[model samples]
Target chain A: MGQTNNDERTPTLLDDMFSVANKRDQAALARLFDHFVPRIRAFCLTAQPGSNLMADDIAQEVLIRIWNKAHTYNPESASLNTWVFTIARNARIDYLRKNGRYQTGIDPDFLWADDEDENADPFREAQQKRDQDTIRASLKQLPSDQRQVLAKVYLEGKTHKETSEELNIPLGTIKSRVRLALNKLTVIIRR
Target chain B: MIRYHPSIELLTEYSSGSLSLAKAVAVSAHLEHCKECRTQAHKLELVGAELFSDPAIPTSDQQLNQLKTNLLSKITNGEIESSFDKYGQAAPSVRMSKLQSGRPLSSESKYQIPKSLRQLIPSFYDDLKWMSLSPAVKIATLSNEKDGTQVALTRIKAGAFIPSHTHTGDEFTLVLEGAFSDESGVYKKGDFISRDARHKHKPVVTKDAECICLTVTEAPIEFTGWFTRLLNPILRKHHPSTS
Candidate 1:
């Protein structure tokens, strides 16, 4: 139903969606929404706990943003999934910042241009797929203690202090676990 | 030149969408000026994105199509800007208290404000209306910040001294130009200064040049000594900022 699945990271469908949206192709956008919305909704729910309403709100915002910022998507720079999920991450941050409190808004220079490797590999998608597989594998390799700390802090939106209190562990130990986990993850991602 | 920067924790919070808008604004401004922090923030956001895209999270079908409807309405109505055209979404409200009472007195000096600031408020010195809080300090207020927060631009003349004061809540000061010194340390352009109730110090402008700063406070100042405390009421009277 999607791109060549030699690697799931191939953004073939995403590429078509963005190019079509750039041309104001409504049908293409509708297709994109039907395919991606469920995934984004699920992702948002996992990222933020106990806020199904907030998760839905974030999914809506992510779609609107993707529709509006379609031209900004550089396929050469990142996979479409990474780009869409990036917007979801920022929207979640906005949800946490505002926290049911509405205000006008703030300046939006949040995204930065990352240095994409120009290694002339024809199989960029396959490479990215491999990278994704490696990243998830690395996630599994993390000690349960470290993964637990990260899941609480990054996914559940708990401060280290709250997580410490919840686990009845010292805050310093929790911080150390997160640090070690980040180092291990970075080494794996770079590999 | 950005010797001072927000901690990684703050940057992570900024990326996670959990920071208050005031803090978000300050972080945004700093990220615009500092490339290091910008890269750090991007990496952190990527990590968050990776965490979310694991494909194992559970989702619902309820109200799935409603989002598409909302988006289609905006796209069809010409409310949103297309890639071929520019979109300028005016903030719904700018009825800030300080905007009505007074405009800060901007100097004829040629210090250019950060270009990114124009996104939040007007930046040209002529357009800027700075109201003098003291002989040397002026504050140009911006939005009607919700949650009792105050967002404003402050300009301090060279060698002028800001009064020693503590805050009712968190105070964030980002140096946009020049430098200043308090009991804490010296701050230059791109330095993000944060203080709370436990910290009290008077920031004096560096001898070389006047300093321009963007300050967001959760509440108004509580002047420490008798003199500035007496001035506090007048400060509040003339400059009715939420912070």
Candidate 2:
């Protein structure tokens, strides 16, 4: 795996964020914002059809939430992305609904990643760095065709039908690509 | 053990954050029980996060650094957004305290309700005003802000059949207590069945005890049987209130 300092730092970043956030550490909060903001902004832009301005606003709100709701995050029920994105997706839906801009309908996509159910690690300060690196490496390893389909479907907020029409591929092909991509991801992640 | 689960397509939509609010709520409720699906959704979410971290998305360092400064200033100024206020709307938060009421009846002790489902309604025990549309069938509805996401706590007496109908859109049924089955298959507690327009069957509770379900419909059902059609008006009326 291509190791970046960001990747190395992120392994414990969530736990570090939680610990320092619970202490109301402003500097740690800033560090977290610097790290997660771009990715979250990207998420908002892709998951919802919003401008850079709107995505920034949403990212700001989501970061503020990470500070406020840090206590409520039970790391056992879900991983960092699951916990954070659940809040982000809900915030976006409610945000869009409040603005009367919720044209996309109630597509239930709360950002989640690997369920650690058999082992709910609420307090484990393990290799979140490795978790992220493995995930990124796994993603880097995916075939472009599979990766593109998965991206179009998940990130671009296109439904399978829409993805098929957009990519000019068969619906079955799209589904399989998604399955194969995820299945491979599961292997790499759990490895 | 969960015998039925939502399809990978639905799971994909769910983890990808493409499912609508109501359908998402239904799936969340199911995930509370089925650990396997929880793991699956979790994996898909990781996939989503990986895609989000793409270096190619082009969020500028200057723009991001500026945002970081702004965020810290906001926090330092004590403008930190509460989870309640993050969405920027004065939406009603579901009261969890209300759901902790006294037990409803025989089934209350029999099955563990998912916190996701429990948090949605005030009291699954007492708040469930199961209105009997017939002798053995009863349903109490909760309103959703979005249309067609009819959230209802439906109870069918042992050996009774749910309304025989064809779905106009997707329908999510999470069995809360006892067991029910149709031509498709048998569904017990924690078994989540997502049926689309192509699916048409009457769920019958063959277990000795009544079966309770948390159901979310993407659209109103078009009942096939003349008997169930009598519920068309009543059902239509209930849909408006159940959000």
Off by over 4 Å in 1: A1-6, A11-35, A44-71, A90-100, A104-138, A142-184, A187-191, B58-109, B123-129, B234-243
Interface RMSD of 2: 5.3
The weakest ten consecutive residues by lDDT in model 1 chain B span B83-92
Top of the candidates by TM-score? 2
Docking class of 2: acceptable
lDDT tens readout by residue for model 2, A14-44: 6666776577877777766766677777777
User: Candidate 1 at A3: error in angstroms?
Assistant: 17
- Listed for every candidate in order, the interface RMSD values in angstroms are 5.6, 5.3
**Per-residue alpha-carbon lDDT of model 1 for A50-149, expressed as tens digits?**
6678776776676666666677666655666667766665566556546644364553433222223333244765555555555556777898999887
lDDT scores for all predictions? 0.65, 0.67
lDDT of 1 by residue, B21-42 (tens): 6667788789878878765665
Model 2 per-residue lDDT at B42: 63
In the range B78-158, model 2's lDDT, one tens digit per residue, is 766554352323122333333345433553543555555544553444456678878988887754445446777788889
